[model samples]
Target chain A: MSITIYVPADAAALALGADAVAAAITREAARRGMDIRLVRNGSRGMFWLEPLVEVATARGRMAYGPVAAGDVCGLFDADFAGGGVHPLLLGFTEDLSWLRQQRRLACRRIGVIDPRSLADYKAHGGGEGLRRSRSLAPAEIVSAVTASGLRGRGGAAFPTGIKWKTVLDTAASQKYIVCNADEGDSGTFSDRLLMEGDPFQLLEGMAIAGLAVGATQGYIYVRSEYPHAIEALNRAIEGARDWLGNGPGKFTIEVRKGAGSYVCGEETAMLESIEGRRGIVRAKPPLPAISGLFGQPTVINNVITFASVPDIFAQGADIYSGMGCNRSRGTLPFQLAGNIRFGGLVEVPFGLKLRDLLYDFGGGSRSGRPLRAVQVGGPLGAYLPESQFNTVLDYEAFAAIGAGLGHGGIVAFDDTVDMAKQARYAMKFCAIESCGKCTPCRIGSTRGVEVIDRIGAGQAGQIALLRELCDTMTHGSLCAMGSMTPYPVLSALNHFPEDFA
Target chain B: MENLPAIERTIEAIVAAKQSLPGALLPILHEIQDGLGYIPSESVPRIAKALNLSRAEVHGVITYYQHFRQIPPGRHVLRVCCAEACQAVGGEALAEHARLRLQGSDLTLEPVYCLGLCACGPALQIDETTLHARVTPQKFDALVDALEVDP
Candidate 1:
C-alpha cells in the first residue's frame, strides 16, 4: 500500500513553502522507490508550524512541520520517509493543542476534507443544509435563519433573514442571490479560508439563499487575488453543479472571479464586476432588494453570512443562536493576526472580552513588546488604545467604544507603530483606491492625506485641518470610503496623539 | 461598454435598485456594484435608463461610496489587508512587496478593509486565498509561483 500525506494549502503553509516541501517529500519518497499519495489540505490554524504535513502510518495522520523545501534532506535522513518517527511528528493532527482549543462549528471539516470532493463533503456534513432545505418551505428556512440571530459577517451587523425577507417580499420576475466572497479586509481570512478550504459549504449556503428568495440564478463574487481559491471554487462549483440538474438543486450559484478592486467587496460594485465592467459603487434608492442583478430583486450576503446559514437550518436556529452574546448570537470566525502570538483562525462564541482574545487566545505580541494600539476592522477601522481593551466584540459593544466590529479581525502592536503615519496612510489608501466618483472621496481624500502629513510633520493648524477634513468627507461624501476614512485618522489622533510629531 | 450586454443589463438593474434603497450610501453602492461588477464610468446612462434619474444624481451617489470605482480594475485583483491587526508585524512591508511584485504585471494591489480574519496577521489575498499569519515575500512568491491566468 502506498503512503498518504496531506499538506495544508493555507496561505501560511504556502508562505512557508509547503508546496515546495510537499514536492520535496514526493521526490524523496520516489527516490527511495516508494509510492506516496500527496494531498494538499486546508490549514488547521497552528500556523506556527506551517508547511505542516501529515503522513499516514498505522497510527494516524502524523504531523511534521514548519518544514521547508530545503528540509527534505534532513527529513529523509532522519528516517522520516519509511514512517520513521521524528520530533516534528505530532500524532493525530486533530488533537493538536491549538486546534483542539477551538470550538470549530462552521469550520468542522475545513482543513480535513478535500475541498472539491462532494462525496467527501457529504460524508463530512457538506450538503446537509441543502438536503435540509429541500425538505423545508422557503418561509420556514427564512424564519429559522431569523431565529438564529445570524448577522452579516462582512462588517455590517445586518440580520441575514431580514435581507432574505426583503427580497422574498419584493415583486420581481427575476431575483438573484449574490454571495459576497470578497474578503477584502486585512487580518480577516475567514471568508477566504472558507472559500478555499470548504468551498462546498459556501456553495450550500448560497443555494439556500437562492431557494429562500425564489432566485434561479446566483453569483459568488470573489476577489481576484486568490487564484488558488478561484481554482478550488470553480472546481467545487462544477462538482456541486451536477447535483442541481435533476429536477431542482435549490439554486445554481455561479462563482464569478473579481479582478481585485477593494471596492468589489462592496456588493453593488461586486454586481458591477460580475456584469463585466469597472468596479465602482452605485447610489441606492431601489436597494438590491427591489432592483438588483439583471434589474430584478437580489439578495446579497457575505460568504460567512451564507456559510453560517447552513448551520442555522441544519442545527436549528436556537441551537446555533444559543452560543453567542445577546444580539450577536452564535459563534463567529475571527482572524487573530499581525504582530501577535498565537495567530490563526479562531471560531469563538460571541461576547468574549477583547482582552481574552488578545492575551488568552492570541497570547500577545509575537514581537515580545508591550501591547500598544489595536486597529479593528480594515483600513477604515479605528485604532483603539489599551483603555478599550475590555470592549466586547459584539456590534453594539464596539459602537459604544467608538469602534466598529467591522469584520472580526484583531491586529496587535507593541508600543512601536506610528499612528500618525497610519492615519496618513489611510487617506493615501483612499486616494489610490478611490473610484473618483465623488469630490469628497476623490479630492477630500487627497486633502486628508496632505492634512495628516502636515500633522505628522508637527506643522501648525494640524488639528483644525484634520477636523475640517473629517467633517468635509463625512458630511459631503456619499459612501463610507470618504465618510469612514476618518475613523482611522480620528482614532489615531485620539489614541496616539504623541505619535504626531 | 455596450459590447458587454450582460454588463449593460446589470447596470440597468443597479439604477433600478437605487430608487428604492434605504438611502444608505453603502447598501446602495453595494447593490449597484453587485449589478455591474465594477461601476462603469459611463454607468450614468444605464442608471438613468433604469432609475429615471439624472446622470449627475447617479454619478453623485457613486462618488459618495468608497467601495465604488469609476475606472476599471485589472483582470486579476490582488488585495492586501492593512488593518491594525496586520500592521503589528510587517504587514506594511508585505504590502510594499506585493506592490513591487505586481508592478510590471497586470495585477492591481490595493489595501482592503477588515476581511474578518483578524487573528491572522499580515494577510494577503490573491483573489480568494486569505493567507493567514507569517506572510513574507518568500511565502508570497511560492503562492504565486504556480499562478496562471484564469480561463
Candidate 2:
C-alpha cells in the first residue's frame, strides 16, 4: 500500500505556504524512490497550525504542522512516512486539545478527506442525511429540521425551519433555494471553510432543502473574492451530478459569483445581485420566502445552516436539539481571530461563556498584551469590554447586552487597540459597502465617519450627534448594513469612552 | 489600451461561453476581465448587444462593482486587507507599508475588505491568487523586492 500524506489545499493553509510544502514533500519523496499518495485536503480549522500535514498510519493520522517547504527534507530523514518519530510530530491529529474539545458536527470532515473526492465523502459518514431525507416525506423533513432547532448561521439568527415552513406553505410552481456564500464578514471564515473543505456536505444540505421545499433548482451565491472556493464547489458539483438524479425532479445546483460588495451578504441584496443588477436591499413587504430570486418563493440560507442539514438527517434531530441552549439549539462554529494566539474555528454547542472562549481557547492576545476590547459578530457587532466577557454565547444573552453573536465571529483586540478608530472603521466600511438603497445608511455612514472625526478632535457636542445619527441609521435604514452599523459605533463609545479622548 | 479587434475577439469569446446562462451579465464581465485583465470601454457595446442589455445598464454594473476595472491594472496588483479584524493586529500599518513600497514602482495597491485569513493576518493578496499572512513592514518590502526581481 502506498503511504498517504495529507497536506491541506485550503485557501488559508495555502496562503501560509502549504503548496510549497506539498511540492517539496513530493519532490523529496520521488527522489528517495518512495511511492507516496499525497492528497490535498481542507484545513481542519486549526488555522494556527496551518500547512497542517497528516500522514495516515496504523495507529491513526499523525499530525505535523506550521510546516514549511524547508522542513520537508528533515521530515524525510526522520522516516515520517511510517509515522516515525519527528520533532514536529503532534501525535495523533484527533488527540490535539483544540480538536478534542470542538464538537465538530458541520466541520467534521474538513482537513480529514480529499475535498474533491465523492467516494471519500461517502466513506466518512456523508450521504446518510440525503438517504434519510429520501425515505421521509417533505413535511417530515421540514419538521425534522424544525425539531433540530437549527437557526440561520448567516449572522441573521432567524429560525431556519420557520423560513422553510413559509416556503412550503406558499404555493409557487417554481421555487428556489439560494445558499448565501457571500461571506463578507471580516473575522468569519466558517462559510469559506465549509465550502473549501467539505463542499459535498453543503451540496447535500442544499439538495435536502430543495427536496423539503419542492424546489428543482438551487444557486449558491458565492463571493468573487473566494476563487478557490468557487473552483472547489464547481468541481464537487460536477462530480456529484450523478448522485443528484432526475426522477420525479432533480435538484440541480449552480454556482453564482457575487461582484465585490459586502452588503450583498444580505438576503434581499444577494437576491438582487444574483438577478444581474446592482446589489440593493429590497424592502420587507414580501419576505424572501414569499417573493425572492426572479420573484418566486425562495428558500435562502447561509452556508453553515445548509451544511448542518446533513447531520440533522443522518443523525436524529433529537441528538442535535438535545445539545444547545434555549432557542439557539445545535452546535455553532465560533471563529476566534485577530490578535488571539489560538485563532481558529471552534464548533461547540451554545452556552459557552465568551470569557472561556477568549481566555481558554484563544489563549489571550498573540502580542502578549493585556486584552482590552473584543468585537463579536463582525463589523456590525458590538465592541465588548472585559465586564461583558462573562456573558454566555447565546443569541438572547448577547442581545440582552446590546451585542449580537452574528455569524459567531469573535475578533479580539489588545490594550493597543483604539476603540474610537474601530468605530470610525465601522462607519467607513458601511459607507463604502452600503448599497445606497436607503438614505440613513448611505448618508448617515459618511456623516458618522465625520462625526467620529469631530469627537476625536474634541468637538463639544459631537458625541450626542453621533448617538442621534446611530439611532437614525439603526431604525431607518433598509437593511442590517445601515441598521447594524451603529452596533459597533455606539458599542465602542459606550464601552470604551476614553478612546474618543 | 489594447486594439479594438483584440478586445472585440475577447468579448465575443466570453459572450459565446456564458451568454446562455440565467443572469449572464456578471459572469460575462468576470470572464472578460479574466481574459483581458480589464473590461475595455469599447467592448461595453458588444457585451450589451450580445446579452440583450442596454449599454447604460452594462456601464452602470461595471461602475458599481469594485472588482470591475475600467482601465488595465499594473504589472502586479497587491490588495491589503484593512478590515476591522486585520486592523486589530497590524493591518493598518501593513497597508501603509504596502502603499509606501509601491509608491514609485509600476505596481498597483488596492484595499480589500477581507481575505478570510483573519486568524493569521495582517494578510494581503498579490494579483488575486498568492495570499500572504502575518506580513510586517520588512516582509512586505521583501515580497515586493522578490516580485520586482522576478518580473
Clashing residue pairs in all predictions, respectively, total: 79, 0
- Model 2, range A7-87, lDDT digits (tens) per residue? 999999989999999999999999999999999999998788988999999989999987999999999999889897888
TM-score top scorer: 2
lDDT of 1 at A21: 84
| Worst 10 contiguous positions by lDDT, candidate 2 chain A | A242-251
Q: If you assessed candidate 1 against the hidden native complex, which CAPRI class would it receive?
A: acceptable
lDDT of each: 0.74, 0.91
DockQ of 1: 0.24
Per-residue alpha-carbon lDDT of candidate 1 for residues A1-501, written as tens digits (9 for 90 to 100): 878778887655675577778788888888888787777888876677777777777766677877878877787787664566676766677667767767788777777887757898888877777878877788888888888888888888798889899998997778888888877776677877887788888888888887787887787777655556667888888887777544454466666666446767777777766654456777886688888776789999888888887777777788667778768887787777777887877888888888888888888888899888887887778888999999987888988877787878766778888888888888888887676677999898898888877776669577888888888888887667778888888999888878876
Model 1 chain A worst lDDT window (10 residues): A244-253
* Number of the predicted model whose DockQ against the real structure is largest: 2
